[model samples]
Target: MVLRLFVPPGEGQHYIVPKRPDPLGANATLQYVVLSSTALAAGYASFAARHERRIAPPTKVSRTALFIKASGRLGVWAIVVGAAANAYYHRGFTTVVVSQLVQDPTPPKLYEKTDKYTVEDGGLAGAAAGFIAFLPTLLMRRATVPWWTRMVGMTNIGAGTGVIAAHAYFQYTGERQKAMEELERQRSRRMLEFHYIFWDKLLMQRLDPLLQAYVRHNGIFRAYHVPAEVLDAPDKYGILSMPATEPSTTTNAAAPEHAPYYIAAPDWTEHLKALNTDFTQSEIENSEREKEALLKEAEYMAYQLSLKQHAFVHSTHTNDDDRQRCIRELQIMGIAYNRLRASADEADRRIFAGRQWLRQRAAMDANAPKASWLAEHPFIPDPEAHDPSMSIAEIRKCEDQFKIEIQVFESRVRSEVREDVEMRERWRRDLDEARTLLRATDGILWELEKKCPPKRDVGEVEVRASAVEETPKVEEPPKSLNPEKP
Candidate 1:
């Protein structure tokens, strides 16, 4: 049977006085929920969309994550809608089959059922007086029904209404932020402020000594979580998939007379591989090529990033131990820095030295404006200008500031890692932002290197002393054979 919107009024004021279509605002609950849900859903859609802007290769989160991130709030609101609708629907059930209904009229002095409260004097007093007559607070001491039951029901309705209102307002005006840009901005500010102090904390010194010879060698102090797509198929992200090179050379010289098969016993030779083929020269070339790869910016960055990722994702080391281990591994990347400088070729040696000098010059040339304590970009480092270092008190001040920042960061990370949905969204959004920045930075550096390549030839830069004019050769004082010790 189709339900009619308008129902005929019952015999005599079955609805309370000042009776309307919905005296308890029961009908209004449905309207309110619908409006609030619409507003909140719209707000959530807008908020989620803001985070989906393409960042080169955009974030490829899992389907489950996408679903939860998208529809979780909507589902919760749907439950509230169901509960409110069910409660209203059950009003008819309670009125017909559940509520204590009596047809008899009131007796004696009691005009109100709440005041009379006995089974014999019917609830027509409440019905005649309107629903307000049944209020628990109005009930007299003689009432059979407890005042608390009605009181509790009223409280629930009010609480649910308040919840709906709160959710609607909160969702509509809320701004969705990944906080990725903000994090990097803060990190940049910190590095800029404590330029020299935290060099060891992030292991930048280890990287700088090796990578400064390469172009666009600025430090990335933080490690970002690699997207599953990129991590699963690294080659797709332009990362080389080659395994570490295998040993291809024999231990001894590559002479047929001293070949492994010729020198070793037959039983031992049986175990030896590639006995017939000479691998010494190829192995040597492979080793050289491997050393040369140290100069490749992209490959070097990928390697460094992998170490950091492992420390964050897979490693068991905690706190300072993790940092120390990661840094030590990172330092190993620097051993190859001086390898080019040690080349026997004079031109090669000079080129490597020139590259090192270029790096030093860049660092020395970097300038920041001096500012007072309260000014913007305060305590900026002055490299070549030889500005005085921070005094003990200034150092202490910066350290205190850093401590506070660290605490805030720790709190944020803790919240994000827990099961808080909004926090998780923030984390995911930040992850996407971080990944985009990483890829974009690599792209920028790639373009920068293409435009202005490193110094490769010494002849072009070599300056010959003027031969036409006789330059005076000045001699210094002669020293004893033994040098003085400090």
Candidate 2:
């Protein structure tokens, strides 16, 4: 009863007529309907599943409907072509057999001709019955199927196509499956990569400076908050997703909390929107810490450069007072630079920690006062508070604190330097003692060589004195002197 039609590229189409019969012919038609419908439904399911996974979400058409419709259309075309071919064959052969029977008029041949006609009529009737086959395919197109089922349907269609093709079915099927899987995997990888890069370039980098600045201004001893607008603007102001892909807004509204004075890049504004909402306290703290560390490194480098420049100038110039003044200024500048770097680092650490604390606090109490605390502790100052008047006493007190802090820091640095110098001096003294001992050893060796000369092949040691020996001649000289006196 099941009639399966497969179309070939050039040979028209082939039909598989099932060997089931019904006295009323209704059963045969119904079975054909069921089989064809199942095949078409399976094919559509497979196509939809593959499409959804590989491509972007469709805006208008649902994937399932599209697949079902396409599959049904294809199935109908195959059946129509197969049925038409069967009908032509039946009609032409029947006419030829009847014409032969009329000319011959043999009893036995007539009987054979009648029998052949009956078979041809039966084929025609079956093709007519095949009309019912298209109904199931039509209905399935409107119904929804699970995703996995859709994939299975696609696999079945692919396998069925391979079987009917008569050449390299398994190879083609394997290759297609592999290619599709690889393509899906690649797409997933790309999505993940884009997510990470987008976060780095847009959100994290933009917010980093603001966080650091906040920490630099506020100490770890006190609780502080970064502004909500600073956080929310990035989320809402999506430059990357804008219509016509125009650059992100660069107006003051897009600027981060503390670093309003600094201009943000259009790209950064876009990135800010793409950042994940679930930012952790540790992450913020780490970011601030890194920023402060970099700032300190820069300050240290600058101080070193200044010191070198001052020394170079002093060496070239002949003025002693100018050199002394330059040296003093260098020392003061070095101290100030260090203090600034330390203060900036400390502030950053505190702010980052405070932000973390605030997040935790908010989690504990839905109506927490953390937001207000953040507004008061903005990374940047309000325009009105930019230049505030201060009393003399307050200014003096501030100066005194700065002085005390600087003095303490300088003293520590000096102590470290002194210790290093002392260590070097000790090493130098040890080296000097070693050198002296070596010299003394060399001198003693030289004297030993003189006192006990090496014995050579010449003979016993002979003393060749520089002074003349006058022992025997002294008596003769004295006698002559006495005779002369007498």
- For 286-373, candidate 1 gives per-residue lDDT tens digits of 3344344434543565566676766656666668976787777655554443443343233333344334333333333453233221
All candidates' lDDT scores? 0.34, 0.38
Q: Residue 353 CA error for candidate 2 (Å)?
A: 4.8
Clashes of each: 3, 8
> How does each model score on TM-score?
0.17, 0.20
- Candidate 1: segments with Cα more than 4 A from true spot: 1-145, 174-486
lDDT by residue (76-153, candidate 2, tens digit) is: 555465456544433332222323213322121111121112222333343343333333444554445433334333
Find the candidate with the highest TM-score and give its number.
2
Model 1 residue 286 distance off true place after TM-score fit, in angstroms: 42
